[model samples]
Target chain A: MPAGKFTQDELDQIYAFAVDLGRKAGDLLMERVEQRIDGSDAPQTFEEKENAVDIVTQTDEDVEVFIRDAIHTKYPTHKFLGEESYAKGESREYLLDAQPTWCIDPLDGTVNYTHLFPMYCVSIGFVVDNLPVIGVIYAPFQNQLFSACNGRGAWLNEKRRLPLIRNPIPPMPANAPSQCIFSCEWGKDRRDIPDGNMHRKIESFVNMAAEIGGREGKGGMVHGIRSLGSATLDLAYTAMGSFDIWWEGGCWEWDVAAGIAILLEAGGLITSANPPDDFDTASIPDVKLGSRLYLAIRPAGPSATESGRESQERTVREVWRRVRQLSYSRPGA
Target chain B: MPAGKFTQDELDQIYAFAVDLGRKAGDLLMERVEQRIDGSDAPQTFEEKENAVDIVTQTDEDVEVFIRDAIHTKYPTHKFLGEESYAKGESREYLLDAQPTWCIDPLDGTVNYTHLFPMYCVSIGFVVDNLPVIGVIYAPFQNQLFSACNGRGAWLNEKRRLPLIRNPIPPMPANAPSQCIFSCEWGKDRRDIPDGNMHRKIESFVNMAAEIGGREGKGGMVHGIRSLGSATLDLAYTAMGSFDIWWEGGCWEWDVAAGIAILLEAGGLITSANPPDDFDTASIPDVKLGSRLYLAIRPAGPSATESGRESQERTVREVWRRVRQLSYSRPGA
Candidate 1:
């Protein structure tokens, strides 16, 4: 009944089970896609939520129900939190409280799925005492499986270390704007401009891309921005170093839990996308899903010299400052 | 000795031959990429032109030379225009003047290729009397070959009729802002905000993405924007219907020649990104490579009803009207 009480064998078993379940679910996704290649697969079964721009389909729900049932039947005591079950307040209760909590997004990047885009995936994670202990993300389209267990290291296809590229790389110039490859997405919350905040969100999005220091340019002008439409792949790719950093907000805990475990297990750093000035990225453990933000940094290459990590830190710090106001800071923060 | 003199069979023969050359060159590109997988390929052999953001690699030069030699040896009477030969004003002489002209991009999306991003490709176009008679764009990563000969319809992998998704699709809702998926890229020209035509370019970019209809939202708040980092893939994907629309300017003629042929052959329509009043989407013949701007639309579905094409044309017209001032016209035009 204590935090971190599970033995190493127990952790490994859970990881193996999750990987199997995730992969099976991923296969199910692929099968449905293959069956519907004609643009006529259960077209009526798709529904829009929050906004027509956001969508969910029968496949998403079917896969979630299947995974939930399998994991619950196998480990009934484990608290399960999934995207489909978000209305049940599953996202808010992150405390593991001596029992394991399984966090999952049966199908992340639902919009991309509807558009037949290639980056959607199945993300599964196991948490204990509010800490993600096991993670597995399966991108079925590309047949890529990214996984990691706490303290056991990370691997792709059960081989090779995390951060596809080795360390000792050069830093982005200054905030390393044009040299940095950043990935972010426009979530279902599009009313931010007219109904909610005073154009902070859209303005921020534009600024990050505007001329570095021009009148309307408050953004970092990074090398590029990818709206890959899949948070799970975004994080999985970041964990793999396919992407340098991923900044996001307004997504649920399950959307990032699995990928976060893989990221941190591989020695990557994460925090609120809009952390405070005193925020120490090294203290990633303090960050919580409730923050409604996820800013993940790739690990320095394995071969990077000691100074390599230092340079990356400086760059990350500068980026943090530039994006400090990204979040809707609660009126008078 | 007249314009448009080539027969359908001649056009087809040229098409078949260019596909072969493009694929061969794509294979050579892959070989070079594999050899430099470790960020070590011709590391210093890259030279910048115009600016540091615009670069030329050894592989680019090598591929251009190889294609030029092969084509010249076989068709000594043809006038060949290539990116590598741009310094000699090869791009300026667009007039066909009886002799056939081969316009080729040895390497398109050089930035993505150098970054190993996997979206770059080789684009080859053949023109007879100023008409794009044959086109081939080969993307080696996905092994997808897109080709179009003037009258012979466009094909992907020589099979599927393009604009990947069949359409008779609904138009974007009035507030349909985020329902439309659009793509635009940030090219090497960063000074477009300063030294250029008074920030018209950046302002237009900001407008398209601005909060839909907000006082600041002068643009279509489309579903999302993707900067895939490659023009060839951008056009290739546009041809495949992976993207609904693509808007670009300032890129070389060779950059679009092949994709343009494929787009037209596929029945897709293209016009300047910002056309004059009374510019007809149906009159695509008036648009030329020298225009320096392109706005391409996805075509109706292959099996679309007669009304389907009309609906598509309507949508294109609306989009064009909304984007009338996209480019900075010289003074008052």
Candidate 2:
């Protein structure tokens, strides 16, 4: 299938369909949450896979199946890729060259779900030619629904625009103390890595982000650091400008697919963990497939005389450069 | 100024006064927030004491003074130790001599305040002989107010008892995956500590926390980690059972004072980061004033077949031991 540019009418149809699907998925999860709370129904339990905490509940499987079935029924020609089904050899490579494919994580934060924390959400994205064209993420518990279509703007609950604050209080002056927030998973492969490389990487990043001015005036002391557990929520919140910047590693594509689209639609910037301009479509597919890291920054005001967009891009690149220069060693290495 | 217990009537009066004070403080904050959001007012500007991110806004000082004045007007003889005024020599040590005292962090998360992140709160605690006898914490933006009196239980919005699960889930099993969530701050004294130590400590903790079962056995994965940016909210969430555990270093007593009271009243446990214990007045006052590490855990079911208070205490101790054994470094040390 060709990478067709969506007409206004096509965009409208897609928006309605995406919203309906998002709400449907959200309603199902909410029902399950209430049932879990009431103790009237037990979530279908599954064998402990990677770890007990990593158990795949029947709800995850059922939810993915429900989404996939509904999408197939509505748009029989569209391809689908979902987290749970992907684990069963359902395929990871997207047909970017085909009609828009749906990439979904039926439940973006299963651990939070099992533990009953209210940070989990349902994330869905539409990709065409390996680029996110439409995205919808819903957190039923918080009653937050964020969606965006390519070239159009993003919205939260269909009213508020992305970057909840239209004009953020101006950016802190250069050399002013800044704060950086990072979202990361402890990850399922903790024991396999040597020298604790992942841990070292995070610590190094935090240290750099939180560094105060030194004797030679080097480090810019950051105000604070936060890790709120859910990448989808973190990304969305970052897009909303609640956080100045977000750096994340070891997350899957489904983890951020919808969030990336939303973030971009909100005038946010995301780059490969490596560096700016190193970002491209090939990298985009892997980013969605969960093989890469991301740095997302809410748009910032221009540097005195610079344009706002240029200033933001430069700031993001500078932050990324600082991150990459730091070397990390895995545990036991 | 004696170490005498309050009569039920006195307790009732104190509780009523605290609730009123909390609501009034919350109202002031909400008003400011609304003004800032509506563009009617500008972000509070102040001198940078430690760094630009470490702002000393006028609102913080004004709020602290208001709380102190209200308390003084009602209880003229009571001592007050507040974050903003303690530098004038009104320290926690004075409160430890068996006198009635109030501990207040007028704005617990000032950075969140500057960013309008909606997680900041007003933390207040009334102590007798340096023991937190009554506690109140209010997050105006979220409209969440948590309060507790020693031996009287805890409440959210004066209606919900903590660990707010309508259906109580059983305590995580011993063999349950070691999924612990931790909270830490990028404190002001980063330069005093070696970057290597910071890297090693964080690496060790995250590594241990992330490790799924290894040679240690099954169900030993560290479930996940979170750093929500506020000590008060972290403790409150822990008491609510939304978070399994919280550990922090470098925060003053004002940061954890009210939270400590609420957590204890809700059947949770608090101990020095160095060791587990039944925290009491002697330890709390000094700890509140000085920078020390703390760990708080929600109520968990006793180990299988463990009966009696002694057994429960043992189980709690074992859990604490297991948790502390997972390493996190002290920055300077």
Candidate 3:
């Protein structure tokens, strides 16, 4: 093996380290949660970034630093990136080189964590030359540990194989619009564009298929739209078929790298939320993990029958079409 | 005790019975889930009532019948009200008389169950006359059992006290609109109303307080909006301070009956989702539990200080105001 370039065996070792590190980090975070629940401390002070909804607490910083130090002690020359320290010196350019980089989100759902919502998680993604090679996501409250290496299949708690591969990859919906559960996250960006703001886009998107006086061919009227306040878990569970569709953006690379590995291994597909009209899957075989825009679909699950596969394809196509109709573009996009 | 009413011992026995029965019912449902994962059965058929979202599968009926028979054999005089049996000459009127009765949702969050959302549960509520006297909710996947008997206090797993109540009764949020976590459910009804529809109302409600760029005061932008798909667990967790405010409607009485008993014991408050402008809490200390529209707020926890008390009151007032602003109404109302 080259001095700087590690083989797949080395990558697997790092993935092991990440799984343990993530579980420990998750324990520290949940300990603080218990503290908050016990009223051991007064209300926490959170520093707002772009908006009130986009805030970070001290635990987030502390957890990130701990993870960074731990990684440094293990791999001195390896680069590390975290959400809290993104701009100090580290940037995407650091990930552009042919070196192993550790992309970590010490806390993916900060808002959910502070509010005592159970959807928060610890996400760590190890990328090689900007390619996500291994991912780990730990949801403490749910006691779920999801991890995947580039080629190895995803696992929940390191036991069961995912997609459980029942009928197909993503579980087919018994029915769409009314019987399917979809996931949507209201990201940190509260900016309003010419097309529509995030809030506006969500309202319109929900109204399109929802029963608005039986509005004809307008609403996706999906069984429901759920926002867990955590992007990593959203992708993780979507990969496991907890949700049929997951549409997310306005977050950075660290938030999704680990999830991307898991989702792909679980047989789910990812595409640009806003794709060109004649989008060719053959050409765009992979989604730009750093572009900050993503639409994910779980491959049909065990419920998907030989007959249902045809309908599932049509539904996936229609959902992709609707994603385009929403026209939600962030300033960065 | 009166002729038709039970003594304290009788109530205790009934509560114990419900808890055990609920756990067993939940187990059966989960076993079926495992069977599906192991590919042991053909696709099950579901019957739709009002719409596709309003569905009931054979398992629901089977579970209801099992519970009903057990209760009937134990206490033949006690009436039973269940979702699967509601249309067969059963109604809240069965619960209106002074006779002891059982109100049950054999499987709550049915849609979640079918889609493997992991938020569904088995809720069994026991009532005397019109009052919710005993409540039990079992989440099989999470292995959580929440139960409460009036004035007996609530227990999770029959061990720990909930809210852990740190400050006072319900923990006060640092800010109502920006720091609180809220729960909202879209029921089975998909009718488009004159002023948009339930789907539109929900979108507006979520966006009104959700973070939107430059929308100013129009958006309530509360910390976030979450939907559990199961009214029972939503109420059970809200009672435990997992959710700050839970606004729900368009479901039946059995859905919220068990939650009502649990929330009241937790020192939480529930009012009509749309309260009259001049509604006086001093005069009407207790909310009408049968109302289809309901809004619940958690009381400060064991840490509730005099200063935190004031903030808790303010946040509750603001959440109530938002509920009224949304103008959510029930078909019965």
Which candidate wins on TM-score?
A: 3
Clashes of each: 11, 16, 43
Query: Which tens-of-lDDT digit does each residue in A1-333 have in candidate 1?
Result: 222888888888888899899899999998887565556654324676765556778888999999999998999878987787764342344333446889889998776666555568999988887678789998786677889998788877677566544433333244454455677776555552443432444444444554566434445655556667778878887776656667777776788889889988876777777646665454433457545677777665422333545555655565565563454322111
Candidate 3 per-residue lDDT, tens place, A1-333, comes to 421466768877888898999999999898888777677876656887767777889999999999999999999988988888974453334243457888899999887787666778999988776677788999898788899886678888898677653643434654554456778766655454445546545654555346633545545667767777788988988777778777776677889988988887777777666646764332333567666777777756444354434444445555654554443343322
Output the lDDT of residue A210, model 1: 48
In candidate 1 the C-alpha lDDT for residue A95 amounts to 38
Rate residue B154 of model 2 by lDDT. Answer: 85
- TM-scores, all models, native as reference: 0.83, 0.83, 0.88
Most lDDT-accurate candidate: 3
Tens digits of lDDT, candidate 2, B1-333:
222667656866887798789889888887886676556786456667545555667778889999999999999998888888864453334334467778888887887776666678999888776567788999886678889887677888898777655354345445433654444554444552454434433533553365554424322355666666688888887776677666666566778878887877787767655443542212322233333567666656444565323332443343343433323333221
Task: Looking at model 2 chain A, report the run of 10 residues with the lowest lDDT sum.
Answer: A324-333
Shift in Å, residue A61, candidate 3: 1.6
Q: Second chain only: TM-score per model?
A: 0.84, 0.81, 0.86
Q: What is the lDDT of residue B110 in candidate 2?
A: 80
